[model samples]
Target chain A: MVLASGSMALATRTERTPSLIGSVWRSTVGKKAVMAVTGVIMLAYLVAHMLGNLKVFFGAGEFNHYGAWIRTIGEPFLHHKWFLWIARVVLGSAVVLHGVAAFQLSRRDLAARPAKYAHARRRASYATRTMRWGGVILALFIVWHILDLTTLTVNPNAEEGRPYENLVASFDRPPVTALYIVAMLALGLHIRHGFWSAAQTLGANSPRRDRLFKVLANALALLLTCGFIAVPVGVMTGVVS
Target chain B: MNLTLRIWRQRTADAAGAMTSYEVSGISEDMSFLEMLDHLNEELILAGDEPVAFDHDCREGICGACGMVINGQAHGPERTTTCQLHMRHFADGDTVDVEPWRAAAFPVVKDLVVDRSAFDRVIGSGGYVSVPTGSAPEAHATPVPKPVADLAFEHAECIGCGACVAACPNGSAMLFTSAKVVHLNALPQGAPERESRVLGMVGAMDAEGFGGCTNTGECATACPKGIPLQSIATMNREFLRASLRGGRGA
Candidate 1:
């Protein structure tokens, strides 16, 4: 009997399959924990990144100093090598972790029940279902901004001018500014739901604290969304330049 | 008063159904929605037709037995259950389009009736104190705080009506499930079984074929009892904590 049991266990092991993995990947609890943890990390990153980016309003010296300061969080080894290497590893890994979790979650979500676009009933929430679309738009905006501001010098790039002028120039176009505004609106909506949800995912909200957390999440989403939107609108309308 | 009701009639699970219009006249403006439904049944019986099969008990709105989407809104436009919805909110010649709650999990059993036993299964999975029926202690044995008691009462107000479920596009019952979870877990007595209760109920909700919540917030908006959506989040957090800590049956 012991030999039979041992052989059965061995047989199962020999034919090893990831059916357990598959099930876990598809479960509400499993998928949600991934979302909550990744979401919390990303949220923290956003706060710090947004605060850092706001340095431009303080002037160029401050702006570049902030950028350089940010750049140095990576390059503590300063031999021109190890300092930024460790930071690069950490930042890159975090992004990868967040991206992988988000991608897997969205895919499982899509696969859990197939929605045929053929009948395409528009019954879903404006905020709940648009995260995918918003993610796309935000990605595009980031690429454009990076290319224009950092990498490939656009025609509007002024070498000696403040970062402020460059931002104004970027949003001077109605189309781009409008796009940014829309993206901010979407981001705000996404984050408004995401914060409390993330906390819930992490098991941080109690009955006593749940309402308070949601209010705080809404306030933060609103403030950041409004902050991001204001810059583009200000630039486009010549309120700032 | 006269009312026009366009009800959904599906013959079988796979059968095609449509909005069949019925005209009801001489209704009292003070009649409860179920009472009005009774009048319709009475008229149908007179005409020798099959009466609409809808669930109702204790037409006073506490049973959560009565549910139908009245005019695209769950439990009508009122912030009360269907049994509590009065005709006073309507005018003399108002036309109301009534339909059963639409969700894959809640299949139509007939006209205006849904198989809400999915909820029962979720409840049965372990939405209980687990104490033996006769083992209940004195009411004041624990001396629960008033605020906690009040919140528990609010959650306990959930008649398990599935109004929140009806309003959710995903057809999620997070609000209902969460309310039950919060109701029991809020009390000192129910805390011993909190972990198992949350884990079992949520699993049962999924197993019974409810959709996942994406936090549209419509469920709260449509809830007759005004069961807040945050309770869903609280359940969410609870479920997460339990799962992380190696809870009952994963």
Candidate 2:
């Protein structure tokens, strides 16, 4: 009896160790951690992208050169535009993972509360309510942004090298500028709640750090929104021309 | 005080439920919410009507046996259990909406009563330490530090009334599960089973069809015991640690 029980215990231990990653992806908390990590990854990329977009304030020569420099990063060891491709792949993976986790979680959320309250009162904050819809807005924006800028497929000018001119061409249209502004605003709201939520999911938040994280989240949302919107505003006002 | 209460009424679990309105009068401000319900029930029985069905054991707040969403707020707007929510919080001639805890894991058993066995199953998974029961052990022998003991006590305040789940927009029970996990995992006596406790409890929680937490703070805000939202964060830390460092065999 002792030998059989011992073997059973051994089998259970072996069964658990091999499926660590699988288990993490399967559990709700674990899937949230995946979403949190990917969110942080995307947040970091957005910060860099926003900073790069701000180079337009320095005029066409510097802005175009900055665009070219992104392609030539890690030139000695990496091929032309290889760094850009690598960054795209990493960012693409993060977006996909974050989106998938969010979709699954949202589906589960809706399912859990099958019955609606008779007297419905607005419970969470507006930023919290907007997370799912804001994420969708951001996703659609990313697609359109890539088409307009990266491939130049939807760019009014479709210029390959002159990013400054291409940006000006795109945002020069009133409708395009309005769409960009709305998407950037949605992005701001998403980050306002999302950054602090990511901190909580990743187990980094505490009573002491809660206020700090909230302040940081708000600051990031405001900073990124203003920075991204500045380029379109600069183009429309003839400041970057 | 005269009040119009629109309480959820279902004859059975499988029956179609709807808001059934009842006019109740002469309710004292000092009467607890449940006592007001009791008065309504007394009137209903006198009129030969089926009274409202709700779950309540101890009329005091600590029992965790009583819970209902009053006017869309869990327990009530007063941040106490339904048993302790006095009628004074409601204005005279007000229309009060009463409902049960609504979650897939916590299905309505009857009017204003939900089956909360999901919580019991979650606790049964690994909410206890393996203590031998021959003789009473000396308290000082375990040597749990004061801060750790305080932390454990704070989480131990969870009454499993299912308010967190009811208040959560997503119907997430992360707060309740986290309270149980953190309560036991903090003490020295619970050290040996800490890793398994988190894993088992989390697995049970997921299997119970509860939603995932989105960190909206709804659960924390509605919690009557004042369980902090940081408990979920603490549990996340413990779950990550347990997942990284594999638990002992089942």
- Which candidate's lDDT is highest? 2
Candidate 1 lands at a TM-score of 0.78
**Top DockQ prediction, candidate number:** 2
Q: What is the TM-score of chain B alone in each candidate?
A: 0.92, 0.98
- What does candidate 2's lDDT look like per residue over B132-244, in tens digits? 88989987788988999899999999999999999998888899999988898888888888988888888899999999999989999999999999889989988888888
lDDT of 1: 0.73
Q: Write the per-residue lDDT of candidate 2 for residues A121-237, one digit (tens) a residue.
A: 987889999999999999999999999998999999998899989998998889999999999999999999999998899899888899999999999999999999998888888
**Residue lDDT tens for model 1, A149-195:** 65536627554335655676777778877777787787787777778
Candidate 2 at residue A114, lDDT? Answer: 95
Regions of model 2 farther than 4 Å from truth: A1-18, B248-250
Query: Candidate 1: how close is chain B to the reference, as a TM-score?
Result: 0.92
